[model samples]
Target chain A: MKYYGGCDAGSTYTKCAIVDETGKLVASVTSRSRINPVLSAQAALDEAVATLDDLKGAKDLAYLIGTGYGRNKVPFADENISEISCHAMGVHVVDPSVKSILDIGGQDVKGIAIDADGTVLNFAMNDKCSAGTGRFFEAMAHAFEMPLDEFSKLSLKAKNVIPITAQCTVFAESEVISLVGEGKPMDEIAAGIQLSVAKRCFVMAKKAAATDSIALTGGCAKNHGLKQAIERVLKIKVVDLPVDPQLMGALGAAEYARQKGLASAKA
Target chain B: MKDLKHLYYLENLLQDANNNLVREAQAGGRLAVGSVCSLIPEVLLSLPGCFPVRLRAPNTGSIDLGTYYMTSMSCECCRALLERAVEGGYKFLDCIIAPDACAQMNRCVENIDLLKLCDKEKFFISYSDVPMKSDETALRHYVKQMRIRVLEQLSGVYGVDVSDAALRAAVLGHNEACRLITAIGEYRKEDNPRITGYEFAVLCTATYCCPKDLLVDKLRETLDELGSRQPDSGKNFRARVVVAGSEIDNPDLIRLIEGSGALVVADRFCFGSLPGRQEIVLNDGEDVLLQICRQYLAWGKCARFMDTAKIEERQSYIDELAKSYHADGIIFEQQKFCDYWGYERALGSRVMRDDYGYPVLSVDLPYAVGTNAQLRTRVQAFVESIEIKNIQGKVTR
Candidate 1:
């Protein structure tokens, strides 16, 4: 059996995954903070290789593909693909019915509409601001004095969500603190924060004019409240895989590697 | 401020200007000869007794600024020069002059003429058909035509003789100003590094039409005072940065960057470095004014101009400066509505990183008041990342 490796070096974290030719995720690893993408990518690749130690001696470990904000930093990769194409490819590989993918990372957010063959048809990205990404939630988490993981869960329990006015994170922080001082419930504030992010993402999705069955990726996808908020605003069903949401870029990269390997073999 | 003494001073200056005896006295009793750009006409007009200022826009930055203007993009240099003209900053001028260098600049000339900043009779719009690659014959013809226009304008305005001697004297005065500027710039690069680029730009702009002797005296004093200052002795300086931006005249941005622990060492800006040391090389030819004009058009890289070779040249210049000055990074400031720098963002970043092996942090400035705190955070984060990279032994080419 042939094996392939994929790495996604993002602004906040580094992720790696290994898969067989059949597209089964044999192993994966994730690390905190992506200060130096090249070094982080090397470390991630080593972890992926170590996870598949049995497959290390496999004769047909054909290709390595890299993608993401820091995709160019992955020196060991045989090829590099755009994160948008990779994200759409990964979403389609897991769920072939997915027509649109909304991937929100640390610094940027992108909404991609994919064709049947997993080609990127249309896409819109928020490159200018951080309000549309997981950074918004991270800021809110900091404001709440809670871990990001716990904050994600807390957002789901709000009964009466109050809306935050500012789209900027700094402005929103002052607004959030003011509301908190006024005796607003923490869960309600969390719900409002999720709603704000959803609103911003909705604008991006609308710009891309994404079709039905949108799949969410990135570290923010782990937030169930954000998922619900997004679904509520867009009036569409959101899709997810069993693996960690952050692994989507790596999964997409591996899928690209597999497709390229098979095509080259046929040639 | 509007006293007759100022007028008398200008009149006496004009009188001294007419007599070759005054020129000889100023030049240590010799014919003072120098060169000046065509744009010197405008600088000349801002004086009390001279004709209008005429200038040609160098083609560059047109596409980027045009995109911002959209339906009004016109030509890049034309738009930039016109925008500056329309700002009414040169209200002191008797009139402004422009040449039909390009269609866009011609349009700009027409638009500027429509504005009532100065006397309409003083406005002289000359059309020159000199090609970019003009031959000797063509240059001579152009120079003759230019001389006629200069004589006519000077005679009409001040009733002074626009003889070769007088023109030569004016050119010499301009050259002396240029020499002082070049000296100051060279002095800044030495052990003390006295005057900053900002102060240098101010001195350059002020010297534009001011009497050569006055400018020289002021600059000499300034340079002396600056040279006497001691070098700053400090370690743990976070990072030395060169800030390049469009219209970074706003001191707030500088304060914000400095507050973030980065020392701004050099810059490529209209209000910063371009105005200083852009000397007119006169000894090469008799048509020194036109030569100066061409040199000014070709001298530096601006958002309003496009020259890939020049851009690379400037990049290398900055890189060398950064290395010599021990700079850590480069901060590119792109103002909103300034589309040229925005389009160059990705390419500029790649060049700085790939070719020069230096990290670049780009900040897009909005016209609105107040700087974005998020941008400040990002800058801090980038600095921290650089520090981390150094600590981890990963900093490399």
Candidate 2:
């Protein structure tokens, strides 16, 4: 019953996933990534481990790999692989045939073209722009004084979606407020916001030539409206992975740890 | 992986900016004249007792003050350099010779002048009107302008000899620096390069910090030290890459790119090997100043050109280097909000991918490095993509 740990200290959240040698998810945890990412990752891992019946702490793990933005910050990790590679690995494990990935994370959106074996063929990420990010949606939700889950659900209900085209999140938040003030329907504005994000993501998708068998990952993927908008624009079916999309990076890190541990064990 | 001796010496020279090389040269009774663009021929500055330093704001934290004069919409590189000028980073310079190379730079010079940022008695600026086009008429005007604007002015002001004999020595010394740098670049072409991209950047930047004669001597010594060493296989990379875009003085971004398992073997940009470190070929009886002006005009990599042929010619420079260096991909490193490169990168990426048949990773970032994690992810993905393609190609074959 060998096991490995994967830590993902991202911009907004720190997540850790522990898996058995057979690639079974043993336990997982997520929490806000504070100023100190190292502590956040450690705490997340500890909380996850505490839930396990047999395991007491990190010492029980065969290998602990790290991924995401603060991948190198996790002192306990054996190696730091980029979040891009992690995402590919996690998605490929779920559906090997999936060739394209659109991961709109907390800060930015990454459009990736990959092979069946989880190797990236091409990729593009937005620069200093939060038009198609979780933060953008969060800000919009904050403006509406509604829970993010409800706002996402409301977008799908819009029949006559009003077009709002502010690229910056700050500007778009204000635009959303102004639209609400002008008696524009909330569902319509939400739909427009989803459309805007979908459009922003497509530019990067085009760069990577991500046209088919798309896998939508990241925390933002949980939004049904945004997913449908991306599918409508791309004209491709977006598949949902077996594991929670938010855990993709951590899962990939665990997979890498498993592979590397096996190789080292053999040597 | 860390015991590269030559890199340590170069890193020391790169890290400490306070009177390490420039002021050391000034203490030797040599005038240190700083310039903005590589277009300012070294012969003009390196006469008898003068050192030419290209202004670079290394480890620049913020341009909050610089944006006050030039709006935040201006190019990050210009704003960074302008901020350093305002922050007294360039106060040690005798005269900052800014060229009217592009609009952003012109704005930077304008702001510096309007603000009267530096010590009036010790510091001054020579805004040379560089020729935009590569025509014969423009060439003549450029040569004349460079002579009057930089040559005659420096000679008159600094009280140095600008004779043909002095110019010839400057040419040879400049050529010597280029020769050594090109030799260093040639090492990168190796299957396992002894020099890393960061190390190469440090070596390239050393020319801008120290006198050519001093740099050439130091480079020669470093080459000798490097000659006895074997290439390290521990740092085996996934694919070889070429860095192409606007001027790259800082190696932090290059270090990040290299960290992603891509070995940067070639560079085609301002302040890079394509033109800057290319050996200067002095013709038989041709004027030294004219030859330099022609070289700078022909080899200009900035995106400010209106002429399509000139842009195509520069594009070929990248293609040829990529082909020659056997590059797997190109990283289009542009500073954020560079109006010229914004257009250039869009057009260039399309042409490079479609016509030239080379993959390009376009990155627009703040001038500083290690701040952006998204950038690292992109570079990593890019390398993985290139590697995956190679594997896919092999399987298909």
Candidate 3:
């Protein structure tokens, strides 16, 4: 059985996903991408390969594709595609009807519109600032003395929502502190922060002219509170995916490698 | 980035334009005329014994003194150029002919005179009005006023007689320089151009800062040097971009865009080499001044003109260029808070993307397109979108 591998070495984390010729995701692994992306990619793939009982070694893989901010830096990969295209491909593989994607990574946010075949039709990115990104939530979590994972859970229990006006992360952190001092409920502030992020993403997505059939991807997609905020702002139901949202880029990269390999073998 | 032989000489001329070339002419009893606008009649200024040097501030950093005189809310370009002048950068200029190119330039000239930035007695400063309307009557008025306000000053104050015969020769020299610069620009028409956008920008910027009489010869040698070189098809550029906006004298910006997998093939800007420099055609028995006035008026439209005809002319010019060059998209770049382009970017991006069916990236950049990571990431994603659109092969709605 032929197999292909894809690695997405993002700024915050690196994920590797392996798929067989039939497009079955056999193994997947994630690890923190510290200083060097190459090491993180290698470790993620190594862990996935080792844990999967039926998998063969590296030499058995037909093709290796890389994606993300450090996509080009992955020395062992056969090809490097942008994470935007990767996310579109990955989303289409799981839910072929998804015409758009919202990917909020640790450092940037992307609003992508895709065609029926998972090819990107149009896209917009917000890398200029950290206003409406995963890093902003991480910074807020650090300030509130809670784990980033608890932000969505805690915010969902709020009865009153207070808006966070500052867009800059540094200024917003201070604003959050002051809001806390004013004796406002922490859950309400968290709910307000998620809404503010959703509003920023809404404007960015509007720039691409994307309207409907959107699926959420990236590490931030796991936050249920942010998902509700996005659905409220866009006024549409976000598409559900079969696999982990963070694994989408890697899955897309592997899908591309598989398609390219099959086309070459036919030729 | 093929380093042509002329690049070295052009770099030296741009670095010390006032001292190396202009001063060499100044020492030989030739007057150096300072010009600020592309609409300025360069052929009239470059008389038999005068050197008409177009003004620009290269790689400018701080503008505290420039801001003190022009204030902080003014255009960045005006401040940068004024900063250099206040620091005694234009010591070689005998007279400054500041045309009312834009709103800020008129005030720049006013500040120069009010502050006596150059020598009060020795330097002769003059302002000539360029008509905003594109009509035969307006063109005629421009010709008449140029002769009275510009030619008369050269003869009366600077003692330089700009005769018809001398003006004809100057037009020929100007045309020769424009011809050679256009030749270098044509090399970029190839699928993978041997000349990168940054190199082309350098060659074009040299036309502004150096003596045209000398630039023509170096351009000829460079064009011949490029003859034996093969077309660069090995580079895997994601898209071909046409940079459209106001005054793009910054070669670093072009370098940054090209560095991000997009090759800049054509541009529509104020001081760029492509649309800015047009080959002047002077017919015998037709007044040379009238022909010069007509060509300068009918050339590329700057952002100041707001009429429907001028708007259509500018859009069609860039669209035709995009079609001919096989450009994949347009990058509309402007300096922050530029008054004219603040409107043009919105209108131009809409027209390019909606009417012409092209991908347009509108970015407001600082004058310095230095290593800003955010800007780089934005450009990278824009180019990637173009690449993916190509792969999709669908005309986006």
Q: Please, what are the lDDT tens digits per residue for candidate 3 over residues B177-280? A: 88988988888898778887777888888787767786677788888987777655578577898888887776778888887788999977766865767788
**Comparing to the true complex, what docking class would candidate 1 get?**
incorrect
Q: List interface RMSDs for the candidates, in order.
A: 12.4, 2.0, 2.8
RMSD of 3: 3.7
Q: Would you list the C-alpha lDDT of every candidate in the order shown?
A: 0.61, 0.80, 0.80
Per-residue CA lDDT of candidate 2, range A15-71, in tens? Answer: 898888888888888788998988988899889889886777876778888888888
Off by over 4 Å in 1: A1-267, B1-91, B97-167, B187-215, B235-237, B250-252, B274-276, B303-308, B367-375, B386-397
lDDT of 1: 0.61
lDDT per residue, candidate 2, B80-167, as tens digits?
8889888877767788787787789889877877777666475678888877678899899889888888887887787778877788
- DockQ-based ranking: 2, 3, 1
Per-residue accuracy of model 1 over B209-315 as CA lDDT, tens digit each:
33455547766666665555554554323656676655554334555665455555665553444443454555645554565445544553554445566567667
Ranked by DockQ, the better of candidates 1 and 2 is 2
Please give the TM-score of chain B in predicted model 3. 0.95
Worst 10-residue lDDT window for candidate 1 chain A reads: A52-61
Q: Candidate 3 chain A: worst 10 consecutive residues by lDDT?
A: A51-60
Cα TM-score per model:
0.48, 0.87, 0.87
